[model samples]
Target: MLKNDQKVFVLLENNNPQVESLSKQLEIPLITQKQIDSHRDGFFLAWRDNKLALFDIKSPKKGMSVEFDARSMEQPSWPAPKTGTLAQAIGKKTKTVVDATAGWGQDSFHVFRMGYQIVSIERSKIMAALLGDGFERLGNQSWIQQLNLKSPKLIVGNAIEILQNLEYIPDCIYLDPMFPAKRKKSALAKKPLVVLKGIVGEDEDKKDLFACALQVAGKRVVVKSPNYAEPLGGKPDLSFAGKLVRYDVYFKT
Candidate 1:
């Protein structure tokens, strides 16, 4: 269930069967573009340029989608070189990864493009639905089809429980749980993150989630956190730093 005070609806602007099906699948109300005025205070899921996008009521014209191509400007190649701080934290030998907190799935997709087999878990049904739609689009891409590559498997559930029950333990368990903003108001935060925070709230049980990851991961547990926040599990055995974020790694002995 979504947090109280957060209202979401599916906007069906046309008679597209797929969009209608998505509305039914999400169990959210299907509203037409004309009906936007009536639901002026709610967020909406709508198809834009054939891609499913999430739109805030305040800025209905501007929406965000789970985009794979957007990163191409910065990383012009497919399966981008595994040479960043993130890759360092994940380790060169890690082959399989479980993204235990796949909110918008950006990190999960990045790891997938880096050539690691990945399984993504998200507890929020709405986010999971968006992820499913994105992965479906990714599968239909020309390169993906040519290479027979599949998008990361998405599991809709609580990671704390799901990690314990995975059929095979992954080499690494990745955590990027949400933390409260440093300021009293989050108006300065990115629009997508602000909307996500409004919908899913914060990851209040990150400590417990971290403990579960440590127990389930075969090689190590890597946690991504804002630089200002304390390590989730006391101290990490190793830490890798990015511009504004940090990856804390706990190796399994």
Candidate 2:
């Protein structure tokens, strides 16, 4: 559910019934293409090639929509999961994980694909809606059906509050709190990252989030941060490195 002040609405090319149905499901206004032209300012959820997506009309170019794809599952061979990346970070020891900051859910998706019972939490209503759509798309894939894969349960709220009230603790708590951009030229140009930054803003309470995650996790809390940002909750018990990101693992004493 979105805040009353949220300007998001459903953009339709015509009086399409599917769009109307989806609008009701999303609980937003249904507007025509002409309405979109007039209100080309805020964000809107629309159908692009029969797939639901969230797009910002403020972007520089057109046809820019934020949708999710499990790249690791789709193309397993090339750019495969690295040795010390997400898979290995929560591999043998971590049975269940709670991803506290599930942005686009790509990391959460890959973590789930690696066979961890995972749950995700996102505070932004817009991001949560997009993530819901993404998970739905992933569940509908033929391979997912053959393998009988289900989407990770999503909890839409401030994770700092939700993590504190969990019924049962998980083996690991994963945090990928958003920080100000520090990447190179190419990484900054990526669509989802660019769009997410524009929409979600920075995680001001990330340290508190790490502290709360530390309280409920059974085994450890894994904080994903750029190598330069320092550890989220001071020094980590162990650390694993990726191309640009690193997982700072804090084991429960």
What is the lDDT, from 0 to 100, of the residue 235 in candidate 1?
85
For candidate 1, lDDT tens digit of each residue in 1-253? 3572238888776667776777777777887777887765778888778878888887788888887655542443566689888999999899999999888888998898888999999998888888888889887776776667888899998999999999998999999988889897856577778888877888788999999999999999999998989999888999998778999999998
Worst 10 residues of 1 by lDDT: 69-78
- lDDT, candidate 2, 88-120, per-residue tens: 666576789999889888788768766788899
Off by over 4 Å in 1: 4-6, 71-78, 186-188
Clash count of each predicted structure: 0, 0
For model 1, state the Cα shift of residue 75 in Å. Answer: 7.7
Clashing pairs in 1: none
C-alpha root-mean-square deviation, candidate 1: 2.3
Give TM per candidate: 0.91, 0.83
What lDDT does model 1 reach? 0.85
TM-score of 1: 0.91
